[model samples]
Target: MADGVRPMLMRLRRNGVHVGVFLLGAWAWAGGLLPGLLEQWDDIAFLGWQHVELVALSGGAAILVGVPLGILFTRPRFRRAGDIALQVLNVGATIPTLAVLALSMGLLGIGNGSAIFALFVASLLPIVANTMAGLRAVPPPLLEAARGMGLSTRHTLFQVELPNSLFVIYTGIRTALAINVGTVPLAFLIGGGGLGELIFTGIALNELGIMLAGAIPTALLAVLVDFIMAQLQFWTIPRGVNPLR
Candidate 1:
């Protein structure tokens, strides 16, 4: 019991920085720094809730599209089609979020749907690329074993191949998520709205409480999202895959 308690205490100390930061922020807020932040409570609310919805929809879309596409890479024809996917994902990853917003503004004219479109485009390549890599990484012998067992191609994939590749797919999704979190800042720019608005407004005003209030929550939200993704990886990937490795 003492040994376990010692390690747990050490971990608490390591992560205690968050508590200190939050306390400092609470102090500023109580002291009446950046009082104007209280005025925009509605904006913060809209930004937080809508951004959550936006990320959920966009991230789900990425997963559905990426997983199946990864499975498809097992086909002999994948090589032939790889170039098209590469080009599409290259465009997705390379385009700036602002440029995506501009294109959407020209076409969709700015709304949650427009925001989703931009995020979807931003999210695809990592999923597709990682899926392909994971499928390719399956040891050739394991595939042969599946074949020798007389499994159909589809069976081999759904059962043997996909499981082994799950870790890779999880990694891809997590990376895309981190990218999306960064993109949340742009949502404020486009009127997709989120905590980013609060942070940006606070920064513009140079109000310590407002800045801390807005910035702290955004940072915490990113951490929260990252934590959820970590949970997902643990649940979906087999233990042998070595998440860290």
Candidate 2:
């Protein structure tokens, strides 16, 4: 009981820290602690919207592609190839994100489309890796029992395996989302029109306040999204299935 209580308390403290950082940043922006930031509030808000939109679109794409591929790779016939697939994904992961964006720009031309594509690629590995791990983690006995009950493959996948794997799958998605949020700021390099615009512009003009205006919100947005994902993970995962919970 003490061990469990300690972890719960640690999680609560971590959540408190996330909220506190967000609030502090918000207060600083609203109270004019940074002289130039208030003047660019409209621009900041617009870029924030763009930043979130890019993340959502790219993340959705990653989920759509990654989840199904993960499921497919876990099949008996494809299991042998899964290692090769993961190695290829690891290569993707290891490449610099900016390089991906640059390559995408060459193919797609500059703008949101290229940015979204790059981010989708960047986000895919975690989702796929997590999905494979989660599916594999489903207990062998549970699967045998499903077979004993004469459940169809599709039925067993949907009713037993997927449900049991939800927490792990969500963990992967949460990681991908966090990566997407952090990476969005680089989108401005390709005319992707996100908070990166402000940050890079501030760097060019040597304006600290302008940079802070963009930087603060980007960090806060990442934290906020992560916190929300944590809540979703807690609520969506089945009771007793989430060992940490």
Candidate 3:
């Protein structure tokens, strides 16, 4: 396994996933999968795309906020109160999601704003904790050597600590993205929009087509996100790091 071949294989695999998804989507649409799903045909085309967009919007925002906080909290200075930091983060994780949505209703006035906020909170803990963990997990000797070289704190973080610890951070994000897939459905409760609407509408009207329609897309979205994260993890890890060994 030469380094050169590894990247080529990864690229091929990446393309393979896209090919698989396209094939599956076509099969689902053509094989009456939508009809067998749940039933909201009043606007099937629009809603399908919207559900995917909702997942991306909510999850994407979580990454933007969570990654920075993760990077910030990884420093040694931040570790002293890691307990406090974790406790604050835990509060976000522990609060019943519905309560957060309810609170957001009063605070943000509903719609996507409120839903994104809740999803953001839900996705925060794993990433923040993992970032700090990754930073801490860096070999102490490495840190000492970097400091000995007169590397400034910022320089040390970016140049030395960040790269070595990135594996952990990526793992954290992958975990958070998985969590987001399930949690984003809560948005439907708030009228913020998502595939959950299909789940709800199906149960209410006993329409299998709509339910499958919604479920398939949400499931596909989760798998797609997971695949992307996996590729990222593999690509970013140093040439020889075993992804699963």
Compared with the true structure, all predictions reach lDDT values of 0.77, 0.91, 0.78
* Cα lDDT of model 1 by residue, 1-245, tens digit: 99999999989997797889888888867877636566656666777787788788887898788778766755787776875676777767777878887787677876777778777767767988888888888999999999999999889988788888888888888888777777866766777776777777778987566656666556777789889988878876666764653
Each candidate's clash count: 1, 0, 11
Cα deviation of 158 in candidate 2 (Å)?
A: 1.3
TM-scores for all predictions: 0.81, 0.86, 0.78
State the weakest 10-residue window (summed lDDT) of model 1. 33-42
lDDT of 3 at 56: 77
Winner by TM-score between candidate 3 and candidate 1: 1
Model 2 poorest ten-residue lDDT run: 29-38
Q: How accurate is candidate 3 locally (lDDT)?
A: 0.78
What would the per-residue lDDT of candidate 2 be over residues 1-245, giving only the tens digit for each residue?
A: 99999999999999999999999988876877655777889999999999999999999999999999999988888998987897887787889989988999999999899999999999999999999999998999999999999999999999899989989899999999999999999989998988999899889999888888899899999999999999988887778787658
- Determine the backbone clash count of candidate 3: 11
